[model samples]
Target: MSDLREVAITSDSSGQLWNACVWDPFVGTTLMTYKGGVSNSHCLSFIGRDFLISGDAVKPLLHVWALNRQEQIQVRMVCPGKVGALAISPDGSYCVCGIEEKLHVWQVATGRLMAVIPRHFQRVTCIRFTDDTTHFASASEDGSVIIWPLCKVVSMTQDIFRSISDSAEPRYTFSDHSLAVTNIFIGKGGMRARLVTASLDGTSKIYDLASGIMLLSVVFDVGLTCVTMTIAESRVFLGTIEGKIHPLCLHTPPRSLDYHLTETEKQNVFSEHTKSITCLSVSVDSSMLLSGSLDEQVIIWDVPSMQCLRKLQHKGSITNAFFAIVPMNVFSNNLKPSLVLSSFKRRSDTENEESYCINVLNSERILCDKKSENKESLKYLAGQVLQLKSQVKSLVGANLELYRGLIADVWDGHDDDEPDPSFESTQEVGVHKKRKIKHKKKRNLET
Candidate 1:
């Protein structure tokens, strides 16, 4: 009974090599790790639960994997330009790839190029589709959020070539930020979607899609790297480079004096990640929170209890990890610990002093790929892959054991209604404190 999970990661620490690793949580081990000749591999998406899309700056080729099997299976499709970001539709029928200056739309089943969106100031940073699939939006480094009508793009394609069909026209473009936009996310629900975007300018803005008007602008103390909304859309979580979490609620006033800090909801700042925050993921039910950081650590936090679950170790600064939903969630202790996708790069000799050499735990077999001519780089990459595989295998084995324990406990009545000791004793809530605002400086800088 393997508990398989998916985790993806990127390693940019080593300027020379780019690597990606996948951890199968059910099997409790890293099923595969890839490195070498890959310049940049970002914007990963699953095509129909079978293929994985990943590529870099020079190569516009999208590396597709049939997830049904373990190995990197095929190159399903190749785009015209470098893919900077990618997003698959909610229903998994289509996918949008954002290149340096264009957006390409493709059909998931056949890998046919459907359309190309041209003429942008810089690379598209992120792309997302509406729930209905009627429209899609893409963000650029140029500080603009463009919304395209899917019906129009599809209709225009019959007469024109497929590549020129689904262009992301400007439904609304936001240029309020003086700096480049870093991330953008559309809220869940129905029509008139809410667009929340963050940038290098240390500000997060919410937009009304129907009216194309700015709803709220949140100015934080530091630059925000990533932003995500809870499943209920009642709370917004912002992560900063300084390794802090700012939780804001949609129900409260966006700019009131007490808006940022609520009386009942305590502010718990977890300083587990030593470096910059790379990615943040909250479970669908908002019970668990996952943070990947440049410090090469993955910290899982129990949301309601505010206790650290397990500081999962990794080889490189975790590029990203998604809590992918699977069948095991229904019978598991914590459904949030399903799949994690992390990417890492080789480290320099300086970093090796603190980082342990990657080793496979609880397994007798070891990977035989020795260091190449570049001993240092090979050692780092080899260690990274070994560690990733070890973590994946552990997850797979542990998940099966957890499920088996759950069944036995259910039948034996030994663990029923008993809270996990790991969660209860450390449940001390954090206190609330307010930071003095420099209104004059804020006004002076904005002006």
Candidate 2:
């Protein structure tokens, strides 16, 4: 296994052609391109470090690629219908394909069908495995999420005589969303592992997996399409249908029915996308954020600064985007990560039709402490310099006017016209005596 970090992009282009391209971010080059697969679906995932599993919606097949061997292993008839979603177990021993409302579990090593579980009433939108691999979750258009135990599902495949009643029910089923559940993500391993779900009902909810209670429900104005959490899980990054990214702090209580109306909430919004935001991915380190939209743009954001670092263009609307660590030993210094994006080419005649394409973008520069500090310092210094220059110019103008006024007074010979203090006092006394005499004359005339 190579230690090099590579980003794999899967594109569904026009003409029913799918291309999977791998990029080396460190060298800024395309390492490989596997083209001409017949899948318009966005069901691609990395199975361990070597194999890539892709499910085709147009064709009922699963294509597995071994990067080291440069060969593809085809698993035919994986699903009866189109593969709506897919998830691989953390241990990489099993894979699950979501076909409409049913789920098909397959053993990876032997490519044998393990079990078929029919659960959701609507098409499954997303699926994910827990960090421990003991559980997996599926979200559906029915606005519900069900967490299933991996042991029970595997047991059904092994023991035919075992009564179906002996198998336990799902670990938990969350039915809080009113509309289709667009995405679901299990928190990183910890004591407080949580499940976060986004829905078309314009809300995202956080649930405590252990207690099976809703911890927080955040309501937004626009429907949420996707979500990702930070490393600490203290904040959630959400993608909305309005092409906006909203970061909600878990610690803060919801102030109103619409959280976006709050003053504090306004600052965290990233509004670069002109079309609907389709996906969001945060780096493992939690320092960078990647967002892809129907606007055909992938924006790299500095999480702390909330500033866009780079923008990557796509030939079509982006379906999915994520950041992954490159295998370490390939680079002299393993500093930067790679961005993988899956997009589709839009049809001119049919606005609803699109084909997929994959793009692997290289991050030539990584977000660093020194770089952030320097950028801040430069901005601060530049502002101070501009302020000081303005102040100096104003002071010079005021001083110049004062000097001109003083020179005019001195040059006008106004000193000779200055009044004497003694004459001014005598004039005041005479005016007072004249007023008293006028008052006595008026009294005598009345008598």
- lDDT for every model? 0.62, 0.69
Give the per-residue lDDT of model 2 (tens digit) for 71-171: 46443334566777888876667787788898777655544455667778998889888888888889999999998888887664434433232354788
Q: Can you give the lDDT of residue 370 in candidate 1?
A: 48
- What is the Å distance of residue 425 in model 2 from its true position? 99
- The lDDT, on a scale of 0 to 1, for candidate 1 is 0.62
Q: In candidate 1, what are the lDDT values of residues 202-304, reduced to their tens digit?
A: 8888888888888788777678777777777777777778877667778964464222344444345656677777677677678777777778777777777
TM-scores for all candidates? Answer: 0.62, 0.66
Cα error, candidate 1, residue 340 (Å): 26
Residue 92 CA displacement from its true place in model 2, Å:
0.7
